[model samples]
Target chain A: MNMHTPLMSASPLVLSVEGLAKHFEMHHLNRTLFAFENVGFELREGEFILLKGENGAGKSTLLRTLYRSYLPRAGHAFYHTREGIIDLALAADVDIALLRRREIGFVTQFLQARPRVAAEELVAEPLRLAGTSYAQAIEEARRWLAAFGVKPELWAAYPSTFSGGEQQKVNLARALILPQRLLFLDEPTASLDRNARHALVSRLAELKAAGVAMIGVFHHPDDVADLIDREISLEVKTIADGENNVAE
Target chain B: MTPASSMNAALERQPPRLMLADPILTMTGIEKSFGDVRALRGVDVTVYPGEVLGIVGESGSGKSTLLRMMNLEDMPDRGEYHLALPGQEDLNLFTLDRFSRRMLRARHIGIVYQNPHLGLRMNNTSSGNVAERLLMAGERSFAVLRARAKESLDASEFPISRMDARPSELSGGMQQRVQLAKAIALEPALLLLDEPTTGLDVSVQALVLDTLKRLQRERRITMVIVSHDLGVIRTMADRVMVMRNGDVVEQGLADQIFQDPQHEYTQQLVHAKL
Candidate 1:
């Protein structure tokens, strides 16, 4: 892990995950799979940390656990918020929701949308939830969409039918619209073309400069080589040959 | 055969008076209170798989409170709340900690409220509201979650064309549909509906009830419905229990209760509905 000095004076701790572990039991098959074990990390403000792993190595699993999508079997993810430090792993639903709206954000590989919701409203949802005026939220959503090279004609169109790359742009636009203290990006650039990838990198650069902390997974290291301050690799646990195993 | 012999034979085939084919929930001596107000007192309820059990009473009669306790929304002051999910051992819900109870509820129990605002997120898109339940169950794939959301919305008869609209943007009936879609998306073993159709227009209420009945039969989901409207109970429930002053005054098969109420309170309720 790289412990680099911050560009700003006295940068605060943004997040820390301690002894994070997750395991799944397939009851029908009567076998257990250890996704990740004993993983620990700390992130300071404005640092971009890259997660590296091969398939089934639990890179995505770790990200999902930290984001509250999957409950970790063991661990504490402490996030520093305006209200003080909170363990996201144990945070109540309402508390997690408030933190998601104001302090944290996630941009995944694909965008999920209702069939009839237009792209503009989808991207503007976060801002509106944070008490932004409807008009201003729309204005900012359009600005980010334009920056990501989404066509104006598609602004009012539903993103569900958009091409993969187009949908990804809208996802990024929505996640980036708010100035989150910490962000998680899972393969965020996989569907983007060359130009769009570069645009995303530049936008990430701006966020890093603004003291945003990020933990990300990218298909290609070069896509975010300049921004990554540290790298962590996960290993996929496999059973030894001819070992007897049972989930219970 | 003589007439008395034939009647005895039919009685043997009838379902048990206080039991069911399979019991999903069995509670005993349940009691709850909010300071001075006794919400529930010494209540016992048994819910069967694929059966709609109606709990009818006026407000403060503990009908809604009983449903809330069963789903773990609020803990009873004292009592046993046991649940028997398919393929799983019987679980005493109150014995577990709050977090474990919450997790279990998310996976096996779903609850809908009378007011749309209580059950639906007013600002979230209908799809978002529906997908949130799946996300709570540890679903990580956005595609799969969204697809499940659409399926539940379709099952609830919500318009596919307006899936993206927020609750505020939809009509009251449409908003209730979104709430139903969200609850059913969990495929919960026990569905708790608290006055699900109370606030809607009579026509809209009928539409919502139709969708609910269709889904109930298609999914074979066990349900406990609490309603002040006796008509709603008559239309949806297979078994009926009447509550007064936080106690069950009468309980029986829906047909029997409708045709012949045994208690004065139940008689008054039946008369009022008529």
Candidate 2:
């Protein structure tokens, strides 16, 4: 519950998550495990902030909750602007959907299955959400992919057969193609090779310099060592920690 | 009856001990593509018995794709794979049918994905997840299965007390231990691991990699590992294959490859990452 104000080196804060709490209820049992408790963080436009934690430390939970993949038991996500903040939780699903189109990008370590989508269509999704026409979105996505050395011949391929590294690169290509004010990358470098990871880090650095906001979750500290402007390290609390403390 | 019993009997009869001839697996002119996107265009790889092969490449270089094809998990669109089974004639792995291919994967090829949870069902107990694959592959009897699973899990250094705990209840390292237990329980002849140490702590990586090396030595498993990390490659691989742009740039012993990479592309790749 510390307020992490922006540093002098970066742009003003672009996105903020406040008082996030999540509880997971197992289907077979009535027991509910608290995944997160009042977790909070901030992302300045184009700034790289490392999210570090051990396994089951709620890092993934917090990221998933922010993306609306899992509904938070309680919290609000704020997209900051010059005059006011656009609160995602307060907005309707449609309104939030529009907001995602224009400002937010979520990249997962694994590809989420969707309907009849190729790499181009997948990358263009955020733009499509932002009210861009399909044709325009495809063009923009292709341009972005090309910049990263992804060839045109590969754009139409389904992601299922793509290697883990290939799929991850494609996933990154999608998130990064649009001019997003906010980006959340969960375990971005875990599956990537050193060269690819370096390429991504440099690309992210350039985006940060251009004032794009990002919050990256990574277990490998070295991957984000140079990119990170600040860090919020989570206490390594396992299931055992919770059990011992709770039982007492 | 097993698909190739006489072959198994021959292999069992003559154990290829310590630096055997001609290696266990060989891939030559293997090509794969999904629609128009050609993944591996003319790739050649060779893996020897008790040899740890590290496949290093940039993203989208077809390294992982190439490894998948070796296990028949991902089939090649063109070219044939000649597997050098110890006592049997060279088997064209591409010719195997679905059932046989799957059976082959169960008995001979096991892969560890980057994600720990992908292989194990999270809702099930540790022992359940560990035993489920083996049970499906064979070893259906309840008592023997449980005892076998318990013994294997313990031997993998994954604590037996948590054998009944679900994935959510286990730490990441413990969860990986669970996956390792499953992969080793079957005792596959070749193990395909993709970025096996990427997510774990350095200490945990050492533990897991050391355990893998030990198991590889004891079982004489030929490991075809895909890693982007050169440090990991240095520790695990006896021989290394350097791939780039969907092509093999260089292939040699790990020491030589690390010390003096012939291809400028490989040199750049080796130097750029660190």
Residue B225 in candidate 2 has what lDDT? 90
State each candidate's clash count.
0, 2
Cα error, candidate 1, residue A37 (Å): 0.8
Model 2 interface root-mean-square deviation: 29.5
Fnat for the candidates in order: 0.00, 0.00
What lDDT does the true structure give each of the candidates? Answer: 0.80, 0.70
TM-score of chain B of each: 0.91, 0.87
Backbone clash pairs for candidate 1 read: none
TM-score, chain B, model 1, is 0.91
Q: List the candidates' TM-scores in order.
A: 0.53, 0.48
- Highest lDDT scorer: 1
Per-residue lDDT of candidate 2, residues B102-140 (tens digit)? 887777677788787767888999899878868867888
Model 1 misplaced regions, further than 4 Å:
A1-3, A6-9, A240-248, B1-274
lDDT of 2 by residue, A117-191 (tens): 578877787676556787998898887666555667878876666777777777887877777777788887777
Interface RMSD values for the candidates, listed in order? 22.4, 29.5
